[model samples]
Target: MPRRGGPPEVNAGSMADIAFLLLIFFLVTTTIETDAGLDRMLPPIEPPDQDVVIKQKNIFTVNINKNGQLLVEEELLDLRDLRARAVEFLDNGGDGTCNYCRGGKDASSSDNPTKAIISLKNDRETKYATYITVQNELVGAYNELRNREAQRLYGRNFTEMEAEFLNPETPASIRDDLKDKVKAVQDLFPQKLSEAETSASN
Candidate 1:
């Protein structure tokens, strides 16, 4: 018949089944990747060493009531003056700089350099915005301190200078020295206010 039309051609029958099986197999066997969130330092739940008690006088407490009023050491203070007072306390008697000094810097010699423990207390009903504002102010204080330390260490205001100062032509050794100074200042930054202490205050 028309050249005996090659053995009544038959379509392959198993491909659809094979493809379905493969799709199921892949769905079962494929590994789903999960995102690991931001890195954080968590304190030990139980420690071999006994907990050291921090002195009350050494801790500077900032209180925020439901009304968003700010109090420093139980005294109502304007937010603007609060930061200045905190800095002054740290600067006084070189106590603030002690931590950095112990960590290997001369506190007595550095100007406007000190590290004081900041304790933040917020009422349960406090507005989230108010809490954030207080936090931002504290962070701003830290940044200001860092800038002052950088100026003291670098002997120049890098920000005020032109881009030429940061060019590739600049010596690597000089860049390294600046980096170290910046690190030193950063190391002195106050640790985040302890949530445990704050919760207890409320």
Candidate 2:
């Protein structure tokens, strides 16, 4: 008769250490996906003392319903055409004051980039993806114009100049010049995106 030795006396002492090492290795080597979010500077809490009056033509209205449908300027619009439409509205240059604007001066569109305001409204149940898509399109419109102007003025893209300005290694003198150029471009085509309170579905 042979004595039973507790199932050969298996060792479990190092199992937890191995598992912890594997977990640490995975944490160090594996890539983690993070949810994307917009980088926006929120407005101040205090409302303006005086209400500013904006012209209807200067406002571009983009509405998203719970069904993910787009109603731009009170008409159903396709997603593909949203960027072009927004660009046109923002660059309309209806007024003769915008010297850098190359738009056709459409009277029904915006007065200029400075006066253009994109008012995005959505239903409470609107798809987040749809809202993000529209937001990207609006921001793209502003970027397009800014790039155009920067290229013409500085021989470099506006975003490129901005990147150089933000670089930590940039020299103080060069950074100062880049800062002015960046501000000039921004002042020319300020992004005036406004979001109204979400509305409930009818």
Candidate 3:
């Protein structure tokens, strides 16, 4: 036998090096990322804004149940129809100020694009997929409106306008002009979505 007693001497001269190498390998192969979240822009904090009363008629309500069913203004609708309906509701311009809006004038609908607010609510058990679907449709509606307005004003779509204004190669003077146009379009059809807290009770 090579060693009779004392449990034989172990080779530990490179143990620290081996451990360091293992640690380096782990650091290189393992990915460490921060927790990702749904990207959203929150409204600014203003003392008086909360107290400002929004007209009941100006708000369009969309609710989602635990069963993943969508209810728009208390009317159950298919997911496919949500986007178009949202567009119609937002572009209604019931108060008659939106010349660019091409919706049937309904007295009970949203007052105008600026005053219109799309309120979303969901139950505590609502599925994230369904909620995201509704949110996407609403965002798409806004995008469509902004695109139309941008086309009417700038002869291009809103996405193209964004590309142009954000391009580093664009001249400062041109960017300024585009910035004004974009701002005007945004003011005309600002994203006025209001999401309420998810209800815990059934």
Give the distance in Å from residue 168's predicted Cα in candidate 2 to where it truly belongs. Answer: 2.1
Report the poorest 10 consecutive residues by lDDT, candidate 3. 34-43
What local lDDT does model 3 show for residue 160?
Answer: 84
Worst 10 residues of 2 by lDDT: 2-11
Q: Which lDDT values do the candidates have, in the order given? A: 0.60, 0.90, 0.87
- Which candidate comes out best when scored by lDDT? 2
lDDT of 3 at 196: 92
- The runs of at least 3 residues in candidate 3 whose Cα sits more than 4 Å from the true structure, single-residue gaps closed, are 1-8, 32-39, 49-51, 163-171
**Tens digit of per-residue lDDT, candidate 2, span 1-202:** 9887665766899999999999999999999898779978787899899999999999999999999899999999998899899888888899878887778899888988889999999999998888889899888888888899898888899988988999999999999999999999999999999998999998
Which ranking of candidates, highest TM-score first?
2, 3, 1
For model 2, name the residue pairs that clash: none
Q: Which stretches of candidate 2 lie over 4 Å from their true place?
A: 1-8, 44-49
Give the lDDT of residue 101 in candidate 1: 33
lDDT value for candidate 1? 0.60
TM-score, structure 1 vs. true: 0.54
